[model samples]
Target chain A: MSATESVITTQKRSIWAGGMSPLKVTYGKLMMWFFLLSDAFTFSALLITYGLIRYSYPGYEGNPADFVFAPDKWWPIPEKVFEAVPFLHGVSAPLVFVGIMTFILIMSSVTMVLAVEAGHRMDRAAVEKWMLWTVLGGIAFLSCQAWEWSHFIHGTHEGPMVAEGTTFFGANLLQNQYGPPPFADLFFFITGFHGTHVLSGVILNIIIFYNVVVGLYDKRGHYEMVEKVGLYWHFVDLVWVFVFTFYYLI
Target chain B: MTMASEESKTIQVTPPDKAKIRKIWMTALFLGVVTAVEFVIAFTMGASAFRTSLFVGLTLVKAFYIVSEFMHLKYEMKVLIWSILIPTIFIVWLLLALLIEGEAIFMVKF
Candidate 1:
């Protein structure tokens, strides 16, 4: 071949020549990935803000064993504040409820993967089964959060006195029995944001499940739709891992 | 029959792989165990720099599994993986900058 002709042929064969996907995915899937990447940035920004606000406060400097929820401490110990579980009032069960919530999210994520796998095999019945389980898990996580939020709102009976004549009760945007205002504020913002994502994920999974039952994807000759939604569901679970680490574990 | 039914008839469906499903469940079990360990540390150990680092490290590990295995990012093309992961580098820089600023503010106030 002539030199110019060879160059032209190479140019036509380039991955970016617009005939094939360089990313090896459909246009819709690629868009979903980009959307998730942007969402990750948003979540990271919120988390970074939480870290900054948290660091700006004067945290407790005393012995960790001697830590207690007091007005003077600008950063109340997390375990001490988040010790309540459902139906077990006044019991100090540190990290148990959140642990369950984490497991639920992770389990749901696993089911989502299974659904995607089933979709790949064109197993409509299997996809429906796993998708149903995933939706239920999402709902379970949301219910757990609602209970946790209510418990936080209903502060402990022995809440510390914030002022000489004022005893701080539950938490709000303005005030909280917790260490500082930003503490409760960040908790609400971060977890509430994550919860919103989970809620939407549940809704999307339901729609996908309905479509699966109707044999829409089966008729369409591909279950790529389930795979796309699976990506979103897994991203939700991934974000929760970070949230659980920062908000609860740390 | 309708065109849709005719199209569905021509589509090839792979039989389900038992091993893949088992692997997915295994990953779920691993995540559960790691979370359980985190709880154990929370209750047993006091707040310290070391403990915080451990928690962050474990969290990253869990995130890796979710993104790679469950999200199927590992199976994607390298160009796609890099495109998604590279932007997160800036998030690390943002975190470091804001944390230093926050600590400085605390020092000034206290």
Candidate 2:
């Protein structure tokens, strides 16, 4: 083939056309993607370990009564474990709080996307407003998580004593009212780790919101900062989806 | 996009378009619906391997939706997307190895 023909043949075919970021994404956004990828593995490892240990047990087998913590193991039903809403004391509402928490995270993610879109259009007021909502959502999620932890730690308000057979109630680093002790450990580790991420996301978002207020991005002429922060916020939401599924649902 | 508007040396303030905001709202609605379905399924379904698989599959769908829509991975370069995704094959490997090996260890012990 002629030199020109070879050059033409070897050139990137439509796919790899853009220089570094063929899709035209920003550097910070690309780095955020990498960071999320690494974080995904960390979560996956923890989750897989949870699966291993959980399956090793005999499982609840439907009823917690027939279940035991011995050779034939039984992990407590998550629904039975987390069955409390804020003020509705003594009510048996399983997964209600978690459902609300899921909605909150998703709405925050929406606000985050809108903020990024506003950044794209250089709408400072819109960016700030949407970002503020996003920050509130994060705080709300963190607060919900705190209440959950405390509730778990405090156990039931006025239930039977702990000496009721092999079964335990509530949770801690030690034994949990849940069937298997490891189950509580996994719950604490996975959700606690996720809560820490949510905490960091809140802090990062506040800084970005402050930046938007001070016209920092406005001066820079672009709101890529909002987009970068949005990526992290969305990732936190994404991980929560999996956590919600495996921990609570399954 | 340039930081400063050509007309103004300062930042140009363009208003957020309604159509785009509506689309974002719809995405949020879709995510919420999916989660609601998962919640309903959790209550209705009993513990079985099939139910567990269903939950895993649904979780994956939700995960992908968040990554694509919220994280904007769908709008990213294919190379960049693959660079982020293909490596996840190791997670599959890690899971299989850990689970199988873990089971083997459990069997040996108990």
Candidate 3:
């Protein structure tokens, strides 16, 4: 081997400099991946905090089966607090509406995947079509969340009222009709944080949609942008899965 | 600028795979089914410690599936996967610390 070649091969190197990216991924993808990981930490902290606080509170006293919608205690059941549906008020359907919302978010994630697939095929029309549908799905989910929030604000007909020494009725940062104060606070905080993410994702999708219509990707001859957005959209969907379980189901 | 007028930015393009399309569909269906099962279990099952653990386990399954399939993490190299996942171990530490602290708070006051 040539002396220069031998020296080059044998040179000691710092680990980070030796290989910038062993995965051979683009900078954009790497950043997005790390970003999602950090985001997951914040969510993990919040959910774990919920668990911590939940176990500390003295829960309702009665047979669990008979109290599906009775949420007036130190540690009320989530289904009891969130059983109301918009316009179908008084007709109790435990977790039914939230289930629909979950499916909606899942459907949007599916469309986002389709859009990324279209982008891979260099089909501009298909990309635009699927992206638009994805945006619509985001809006639908936000609307559902808004309805849910309003329903929560209106207070349940069966609430024990805020004046009661044992149960605090109505919701604020300080108190809620549901069980302990932390229950409502965490619900509002976690779901509100998630709702903000959905809003931001929708806004991002709109920007992407506009770019698609303006032929930005057409000129560039690739739609890795769509794929990046797909990553983000799917992350939102994934987060919602956790939120639904920890906040509603559990 | 000395760039040629006829030249344009180039990128590698691969043809779409029909199998991938099928895979996406199956993933969505699987996630949907899992969610539906979670709902069923929630309603039918009594509130117990076992029920909570079951829901949490199912949730993790769904989360892993979405990350692998929809986020395409399955296609990534091992190094990248490790980088993203290993940091999450710290979260377990955080949970342990906080839960103990929270229990202490309960013991002290509420």
Error of 1 at A6 (Å): 10
Give model 1's DockQ, 2 decimals: 0.76
Off by over 4 Å in 3: A1-20, A68-73, A162-169, B1-16
lDDT of 1 by residue, A1-250 (tens): 5998989877746779688888889999999999999999999999999888888887777886777666555688788788878888778788888888988899889889988998888887889999999999999999999998987877888655565577778799888877788888998999999999999999999999999987899887789999999999999999999998888877
Ranking of all candidate structures by their lDDT, best first: 1, 3, 2
For B2-82, candidate 1 gives per-residue lDDT tens digits of: 876676677677888888988898888999988888988998887889999999999999898889889988999999999
DockQ score of candidate 2? 0.57
List, for all models, the DockQ compared with the true complex. Answer: 0.76, 0.57, 0.51
- Candidate lDDT (C-alpha), each: 0.88, 0.82, 0.84
Model 2 score (lDDT): 0.82
What are the per-model C-alpha RMSD values against the true structure? 2.5, 4.6, 3.7
**Candidate 2, residue A189: CA error in Å?**
1.1
| Cα lDDT of model 2 by residue, A30-106, tens digit | 78888988999999988888878866665555464443333224566778778889999999889999999999999
Q: What share of the true interface contacts does each candidate keep?
A: 0.87, 0.74, 0.63
TM-score of the second chain in candidate 3: 0.80
Better of 1 and 2 by TM-score: 1
Error of 1 at A38 (Å): 0.6
**Reference-based TM-score, model 1:** 0.93
